[model samples]
Target: MHESKLIIAGGSGFLGQVLARYFKTLGWEVIVFTRSPQANRVAREVQWHGETVSQWTRELEGATAIVNLCGRTVDCRYTTKNREEIMDSRMKPTRTLGEAIARCKNPPSVWLNASTATIYRHTHGPAWNESGEIGATPEAKDEFSVEVARAWEETFNTTATAHTRKVALRTAMVLGDGPNSVFPVLLRLARLGLGGRMGSGRQFVSWIHEADFCRAIEHVIARAEFSGPVNIAAPNPLTNAEMMHLFRGLVGMPFGLPASEWMLEVGAFFLRTETELIIKSRRVVPGRLLASGFQFQFERMPDALRELRMRMTGDVKCTLPLPAI
Candidate 1:
């Protein structure tokens, strides 16, 4: 993949930084598009300040792939302005790239954009696959995510996807060996004896380790057969209660309290975030990826938890090592 330029729209972000390291190792000339003035000097990163798509629309020349990871952090409080920002952050960049591809003389062959499994309904039991139903009407979901997914996919399909071999990654919670993951927050809560399941602990968590996440993207880049929306998550999705139980065992702490749904709602309101982020149950399985013969490094709950804890504490007491993706 050396000098096989891959343009990352939000290359300076948390997941973007992880991808930067991975692609650099694979020898892909990574170009991170950011508005930050200091972003240009950051090794292997280049500045892309244009938001209107007219500027340097031709710069994507000779690119083999374009991975779009741009989006406003959805965990923050979602005010009217914040919601608009969230929608625009994702929709605009996608539209920008789509328009660029439509007009480019030499465009990228592949386009992989970031999406979430949260687009699915809150199902405690019913499982979803790649061929599952995608709701045309926005059901009882928060305003931000409701409109955002529609606009995003619309732009990707109508604009960029038409010109390129596009793949939308409907990713679940991605765990990695860094502070950017939700592991620290959960770990800290457990250490303080405040850790337990959120809400009823019935919601399923479909997760992928950072290594596998990167590997999956690489696979998509190499395979032209994978197009459309692919579920970039682990097949085994444990219930929130079971996941918390594993955390308690790994951290060697007692489960203190289960976060109440009402409390979560109140907190979401206060935090300016959508409570659906906490309460929504997504039991998504990687049917397509598995069918495509993708192998998982850490497929089980206890194993993923144990290794994640060790990486965080810098203390290796167990025999199990980090699983290779």
Candidate 2:
């Protein structure tokens, strides 16, 4: 019997590290392709420039699965240089991976590429599924973000890799205990009584717990029917106001202050981040995942937040058993 192997490109980041640990515990050999290979890494690291093909192409030859999470963090302000870096970081890696897979004698069974739920148009009306409207709204100030998402998917879709099963993971804001994750930032705000609604607070925030995110990825890899653009978000997406309210309650805080649009803009300028990340309405739902009968362990925000709080406080261990694939 051959041992299962999983190769993750750009696996040095937070999400990549999460997947590496999760899959490793499930008895699969994990290989991480990183620009900087550290000796104390969780998985075997292979150095490779994300844009070009090199000796690292050999790692994809007979792997069980390949997950591409290569992209620059979008947490900073969208300056001219940052925009170019963001687009190139995603497009080059996706194109390079596809080219490498085409050269493989035995390509990985499945290729899961990272995408964003922000691809959907900003909406306060109905929730967006896989077939939702994918345009930028002027109010959300998401023109550049939508442009990036469209190009990222287009690069992956146009890549010619017939033998490998491809799936674009339109992942939502994943809540986890990682230092770079959004959960801690929000938790800190809630504790400081600054956890309040921003810009009228009508925008919907779509998110998923880190555990369910891994499970959904496993489901996508195991299920043959899951292909194309699959939304990896929780079914229930609440309003920003509601989410902040929940956060305040979870942290045992009362009387939090609300921030207007101007306030958010000022804060964003100081923080060197964009307000679109907070103000955009991303009511994305996992239509494909749900239709395929995949269940989320943390469907509701309250449950997910409680679990994260427990883990943060050291009341619960982070070791989550992998669901049967």
Candidate 3:
């Protein structure tokens, strides 16, 4: 019997690479659709423009699963040109894929589209779940990020794919070992003695380990009942201060200096990124996943950070030395 095939659109980035490798290890033939096709890639690569339909659409004809992670990174300054590209990057590829799938004689059974926790309103109190309300408005400063997510998901949901089960993954900051991941950024700050709370330190940081992220994607693929938007985040949400403190402990650092909102704004300007990435309270929870009995491997910040440290440093036995819970 032939192994099942999985097609990943925009599978060139950090998360996409991780997912591609993951499903491939499970005996699935992974096909990656990327802009810059590398000669050294393990998975079969198909060059794509991301905006228009082409021969790449044929890869979707008889695939087991299709995952689209083609959005432009939201880590840079929200310039007018950048904002337009950000929206278009996500919207165009999503719509194009939907159209391709609809035209397929044997469309993939599941289609998991990338969305973000930023789609939820910035909240500090209650944890926003999959059923949470959409938070971005045209007048909001961080409206660009929210709008991009909204439009990406809307394109996925509205596009007619009767044979395919669609699931919008409202993911959070994924903590992993890769250089492009958020882990290295925080680790650098901690090593420089600046791994402290940002602004008021009360902003909630909803996150998930990379392992859990891959697992959740597989879980959704297996469970036919899970459709529409699903929160792919750890159930426990921590404040910015608490998360940083744990990161410090994981790296064996004792202390870090806190940054005020004004300081954050200045640093962001110099770094050419937005302070909204740090200041916004992303208090999201995987209510649907937990309710559906999806158990998280690393539910706590300490556990997740420790796992990341092991992967980075290759010291498997370096346990957490902090005080007990």
Supply the global lDDT for candidate 3.
0.87
- Residue-level lDDT of model 3, residues 95-210, one tens digit each, is 99988898999999999999999899887668888878787633225577787788888888999999999999999999888757999889889878999998998888899999
Task: Report the number of the highest-lDDT candidate.
Answer: 2
lDDT of 2 by residue, 50-80 (tens): 8788899999989999999999999999999
Q: Point out where model 1 deviates above 4 Å.
A: 37-43, 54-58, 136-144, 160-163, 318-325
Count of backbone clashes for each model?
Answer: 2, 0, 0
Q: RMSD for each model, in Å, please?
A: 3.4, 4.2, 1.8
Q: Which candidate, 1 or 2, would have the higher lDDT against the true structure?
A: 2
lDDT of 1 by residue, 175-223 (tens): 7766567777777777787678888887778888887889999998999
Error of 2 at 148 (Å): 0.3
Please, what is the whole-model Cα lDDT of each candidate in the order they appear?
A: 0.76, 0.91, 0.87
C-alpha root-mean-square deviation, candidate 2: 4.2
Alpha-carbon error at 98 in model 1, in Å?
1.0
